[model samples]
Target: MKHVLLATTGESPQVVTETLFALHQEHQPWPDALYLITTSRGQSKAREGLLERGHLARLCDELGVKQPLFDNSHILVVPDANGVPVDDARSLEDHEALANFIMTQVRNLTADPQQSVHASLAGGRKTMTFYLGYAMSLLGRQQDRLSHVLVSKGYESLADFWYPSQQQGQLHDRQGAPLLTAEGKPLIASAATVTLAPIPFVRHRQSLPAILPQTGESVHFRDVVRLINLGEQPEALRLQIDLAQQLITVSDEESDQRFEFKPSLIGLAFYAMMARATCAEESDLTRPSKKRADTALLKVFLDELMPLCGLQSCADWQTGLKQLLDWSELKGQVKDNTIDALNGGIPDYWFDQRKSELRKLFEQKLPLTVSRWLSPEIIWAEDGALLEQPGSTKGGGYGIPLARKNIEIINC
Candidate 1:
């Protein structure tokens, strides 16, 4: 199997040699090839310090190690959207291109079953290192590795420094001042310390759906990481709606655990309706209904609320429920109609205000974390109106995105 060293670098190309020396001391397998990701300025410095100055070749010769296959072609400069080599990643576009480039390289390397990649993030800007590390986590295989090289203080960022030489040699700082050890002795290149710290990561490519490169869409780093984390959790959540108790029970089937939320009558009605819609695979939950409530849908909402509101056994409950269910009657209340008058006459507007109130009540009743997790799955709105139809809609809405198999609706 071929071993590959994939690294990112900025102005400091010595990181490569330092990393190689540390790996050698640890008796790790040496790479047969070296690939570097950098910027235009970084490319120039690397070529000058490693190739032109013969530091790389000298290190291999002195260490009695075979030189890896690294040359001008092995250096990849991050490019802008216009295909121009980026001088530095200072702009948003440059950063995006850098991410894409790192992801592409990681994907390409992982595609080959015969190769194992060793990624080093010790060299390069913080953003560059972050992108490289994240990309590797996304696509790395079991055999792949990630690491950061640590050089002893005195030798860090020294221009003439490459690795600990076989013979003792004086080290100088960037400004040509002699670097000294803590004992006040001249720093010797041969005695410089280097350590390779391996980074632990969760490789999620196998767990996630295969994302083809040809799609021309780059995956957001955060999204990839979030999905990986979610996969590591116990299991997907299952929801149970109890209309009688005006409660929503969220359970993790794998852990046999549950969380309950008690919402107000209006909130419970809205939530139960959404839960039922999700269970039935209804997608039209975001569509604006005609100004008047659909009688059947109105009944579904009322049925959920009546039990919770203690109106089920009242002699005038039906009359009160009808007035409460009327969107015009509800809307008229916001226009200064007394609560008593709202129970008798209808008006002209929709019942969006009620939906908003329900949303706030439902969210406020749950723990912030649970509310965030459940919000997208159970909320829907269109043209300021709550949607409760049995079909899917393309417009914005809130409701659980779960299938009927995951939801259970009980009368009590």
Candidate 2:
């Protein structure tokens, strides 16, 4: 029984939407067993607040995910209340329970005479995804497999990702025709008339920008790492895009004190990894003891960027950056200092200059050109309003549909 493990955790409604979207898109064999582990609160505000509303419940219903019975089959439920907190003293105990849950589920799935297992770790918190993945490594049979869908680019529209159906909409004016130009001469032009079909369950509106975008919110940097691992999903892309947008919104909010600083999503992600890697807590978290130096942060940062930067293809530049970052991490070197500690060693301008240069290089190398890849034409119904039928649950129902209505467009 090739069991595809489609799981989701966190507050982003998009996570579940993307998971279901992927499952349907591939038309892959259905899971023999399924598991979902929800969390109650987290080390970060967004994570903690995710469980606050009826968000999880609504997501499950919208996606048609069955509640888990474990039934020696598959199961789904919240960890502690919704999910176990990483910072909670009970993390070890919670981790054990998670391991057991996975073990039990896998054992049941593979018990049949004609069964094989294949699990896909699509979405969840970092600890949750990591712990679950680690557990799968242990319990997986020789035939059992594990995989994760990574985002090669960012969020994209569903239309671009999926082929559209002509039955869903109609094009009125289809033409390659000659028209009178400014000189009253005929010129070739193209045009089309189209009609849109209904879209359901999508939140079409954009929210107002927050105050103090650059000040940075209480973001769970760890969560960002985990979500990014599930690359290219519309949900994952939106979460990252939303973060970048929020930062801009915050800057808008604190306009009086705002400075012109646009933090690149890739840069911020790399910075977060460095902050966590060099933290004394991480040294303790790992098994084998390794030396912790100020420069260690720079090394960690470079290692993370190497893959994303496609450095292996550019060996000369890769070697140069690696050596420079290595030197920057050395004792008494000021380059490795967190954003707060620049003044005592290298001039503050140098740090900013390096970051600017790095950002430019990345832009040149891997430009944010999702637009160039594919453009999803989301056709909204005649009503500019989004919430379909506020209180109704009929066929046309009430809410906007996730797959097509609030169509997400990601550049490849």
Candidate 3:
């Protein structure tokens, strides 16, 4: 597996080498790659200290360890919209740009399942540190880790101290005097102690909303934060598939009001799965297959509707629920009415059409956040949106991720 060390650095680029030494002392594998995020002046400082001065190489050579991949590209400098690097983060725009840049990189890195990050939160601006740490908490998995390098007091402020060396080396104090130990011996680089402090962080991926935009799109840090803080969904809303009334009803417990609106037959049929799964806590929700209609496929949809329809008394019904109640003949009649439209016993176009129709209807009628959650487009894997089994097209089939206590399927 590829192990990467991601760190934010400022003028104190020694944080990288110190972090490396700390990891080495803890018996951690040398990272396969190393990345430093910083601003223009910080970039110059890192280039001079670690690259030009050969401090990074010297540390590795003195420690007898191979160096992780490091070069100019590894030092990522935050830049402006015009691609020009800035000296420091003095403006709000610079910090915003810095956040997006850092989070974007972290997102791309953690998206790879084979990679594990050892994020060193030991450097960079206070905002940069916060952004990187937050990014790790949001996107990091179990295998990934977060750490900070803690240098003992004597070495913490020493500009020349990167890591302890095997051989003794001369060093000056802040006063430009020959630094000496308690015994008046010359201060040595090898005498300093660096410790890697592990930071406990919560992984919030499990708590993200089910309606996140489809995967693979670039997600901004602020947008993600906004979604996470979108607050709680209105819980006690009953979604009634009133077959008798030929309309759907949303009951808001807090307001004690009922919202009634009729959807097309196809829309009603598709929503039955979403409403049932959300209210019943069904674990096997899935999207229809793109193939010819079959009894088995039709059964999947019927299974949800049958219980709500109470088919035995459908003789008194005035809606199409009666024909839909007869599961055996339902597939043939549906395929015959909509010839060449069956895909997994469902019309091929109905999936997209019904979702769009439902969205518009609920948006126009209900005018609440519940409308969106009830008919979300994307079925997130960890969002409890669907079962990723042999027949489930995970995202192809949608499920409502609302709490069962918040949802009740009233069959009218």
TM-score of each model, paired residue for residue: 0.55, 0.27, 0.62
lDDT (CA) for every model shown? 0.69, 0.34, 0.68
Better of 2 and 3 by TM-score: 3
Give per-residue CA lDDT, model 3, range 117-236, as digits (tens).
999999988898999999888878888899999987667757767788766487776677787777787878887888999999998654443323124555556656643433344455
Per-residue error (Å), model 3, residue 41: 0.7
Better of 1 and 2 by TM-score: 1
> What does candidate 3 score on TM?
0.62
For residues 1-412, what per-residue lDDT tens digits would candidate 1 score against the true structure? 9999999999999999999998899999899999999999999999998899988888888878999999999999988766689878778877877787788788877778788999999998899899999888878889999999998877888887899996648978778888888999988898888999999999755544444222345544443443334333423657688876667787666554455667655566667777776666554554345454344444555555556544452235346555454543555422234223234222222235545554454344332333334543423444534444312444554465444576778875
RMSD of each: 17.3, 27.2, 11.3
Residue 380 miss distance in model 2 (angstroms)? 81
Error of 3 at 7 (Å): 0.5
Clashes of 1: 14
